[model samples]
Target: MEQAIVIRSEIRKCMQEEGFTLGGFSKATEIRGSYLSLLLNHDPHKYPLPMRHFDSMIQALGKPEGWLYECYVDECFITGKTDRRRVEPFLLRCAELGKTECIERVLSRLMENLNQLSLVFEIAEKVHAAGNQQGAVPFYECVAEHEKHQHSETLAISQYRLFRAALGQDLHKNRFAATRFAPFRKRLPVEYQLDGLLQLANTYYTLSDWRRLGECADELIALAKVVYQEQHQRKTSKREKTPLNTERHLVLYYGKGYLSKATAYEKQGLYAESKKCIEGYADLSWFEGLDEVGKKEVQMFQIFAVANSYTLEILMGHSYVLSEYTNYLSMHKHEILSGLATILESANKYGFSVDETLEMLSKEILEFKQREDLPGLGWRLRFHYYLSIYFLGKGKIAECIENTLQSLDLSVIINNSGAFAQAVALFELCRGQATDAHLNNYKGLLEEVRKRERFNLGFHNY
Candidate 1:
């Protein structure tokens, strides 16, 4: 009698996990509960119910098949009157089961398919809301990426709406603030080209690939100038001028050209030309009118100019300090002291010391030490460092070690990051050790140097 009666029950596991019963799933998926109950429980292989009903039930459970299978009474799973099935059910099932590996794999593949993106962004927003900014950035990036075959007029129109919605999301994303594609920049033809150029230039800068930086900067400046001139002409005929903010940025762009020019010259060992280009870097009156944000930005740029000036001088094999060579040393105590320190270091490291170079360096160092007047000049002023190093070259290890320790101490007191960092950077680079043991000792010394006065705002002390 049990076999004779046709027993029926809907397979409700996937539906229940979606927070639904058969009827609830029906309402969500727009399928009648009775029909869903029939479809889930039925052996479709035998009775062969409607394919749309099967798809609706799957969709109600938040499933997405690759393509809907168009199956009639008798059709193959692959080639029947149907689409290729996506089988998103396995992923949802894995997620419900809390199988982490399965969830990661499923999500990875799902993100790759651009069609499954809206849900991806929704999931990312949830993750971000749950305080996983690092995790959310990649998902946001994936959502913003264009589908290879799907970008057309309809998609272009929808992109702005989606991007705005993504930006408006209430979630924690600060850690991902610098991530690529999280905010989704405009992809207008003009914007798209700008993006490409920006990327090209950034790659060169990050890698310190000067040749490429020069090439890209040359191209970008040409393009930007032409476009800017056209816009300038158009605005001249307009009733009102371009906004003040826009005007400031246009000026800043010119400054960037100068910066790029300076960098090129510096790399080419044309130190004077580089210094000339960057000398008036912060004297822009445009900075005086800047709002808080703009002022902060200009300040950072000035800091960079100072840092670049120091680097160029170091690379040029010249002691602008102690060697009547630098106009900058004529202006400030800081430049004079720092330049003398660097030149002393160079004389000791490289055998480029003229008799006067060593004599003048020691006198300057001793004079600065006796005065003990500079706030951050403690380690820098201690020890007639060049003579000490010259003695080291003549195998005076005890005196060399003593002078080294004094310089290291001064590095700590003044918070002179460049001096501290370069000491370590150079020790690693220099291979002229008396023995393997001594080499290891110097390496250990580098490791023990404590960095104080921490600030990531970058340094202004050139």
Candidate 2:
């Protein structure tokens, strides 16, 4: 029998098993009897099933979710037609529904041909880009595991992306993925290795694993040194060197390493050490020809470092540095609001009148709220989070709670774990002052988040 005919028979059997008559099922599902019969009888020349009907029919017949689609995809695979254009919709349907078992079956078949991995990767990227990080993690893991033995840069890049995707899904899973970074470290091109380390450092930051972040930053800084020295040696060995314009990228790369190290130190409360690293980042010379986007990113880091330096100085009683930091801030646009917000929080802590700063913060928040073109919502959420802190310090519990909840809402929208973490922390801080119902509400939400986190990590033993 034709595979499609066999699938149709299976569907009919499922309906019969559920004691659902064709006319009754059709009426319940709002699918016309004639059309339903055409679909269930499997006329080979009939158009393929629409995805919407598959789910409705599955429910109406008491079949498992994705059962019909999975069977169809399996048939397509067996008939050697899985690569046909028509099969893409079925494959994507499986991915959209998070049918890992079906995806795994498809991956197993594709593994026999290395060239077919691209299709698998495309689906994985599609899942990840759709904000389904959990669904994408396993697919990337499968690809990385299978490709590891291939000893290609492709495998290394796959491993790096998998590590990132896993981190997004669960920090605990990423802890295991981190170990896989080593073998790929030596296999990748130099540029890939550098960027990979930077990416790993970012994951460490996300996990708040300061020690690991510092370690990764050390490796990045060392690699940057080698690149810098090689360029310097080329200049000395010959009277000519690569375009100074190209050198700007190298400088920014090295500066990124230093920036990482500085943030790690700051997290550890080693203010003096952090300041030195940030200064090193700020001292790098910029050359013309660096693209505007790169320049903007690098400048943001520089301004952030400067702002952090101001906070550290104030905390350490070196208040004299505040003037210098404020002078620099005065020159930049209001987009530097993140660092400015931090400074405002510090100012309130030290008895400085924050009225002016508070006004500025409110104005910026209002402005951002009205503008639809702005991106960087994560940063904006963090700004709201910091605003909550400032309000708490001022003993404005209502405003503090308001901004904290706003931060939480925005964090949820953007899926920013770091901001979400801070928002939760703020809620915990407010529990003592809040009513019993509010406290219980906070506890319940936290517990739910904790449960989901453990579940996503596959912590079955726990």
lDDT by residue (tens digit), candidate 2, 50-134: 5567667777777667775656655545435454454455567777787777777767776777776667667677777787767
Candidate lDDT scores, in order, read 0.47, 0.66
- Candidate 1 global CA lDDT score: 0.47
- Candidate 1 per-residue lDDT, tens place, 128-173, comes to 5565544454445555464443443223323432333333111112
TM-score of 2: 0.59
Clashing residue pairs, candidate 2? none
Alpha-carbon runs more than 4 Å astray in model 1: 1-21, 24-195, 239-253, 279-295, 317-462
Kindly report which residue stretches of model 2 are placed more than 4 angstroms away from their true locations once superposed.
Answer: 1-103, 110-139, 147-154, 166-183, 228-249, 286-305, 318-337, 344-353, 367-394, 403-462
TM-scores of the candidates in the order shown: 0.40, 0.59
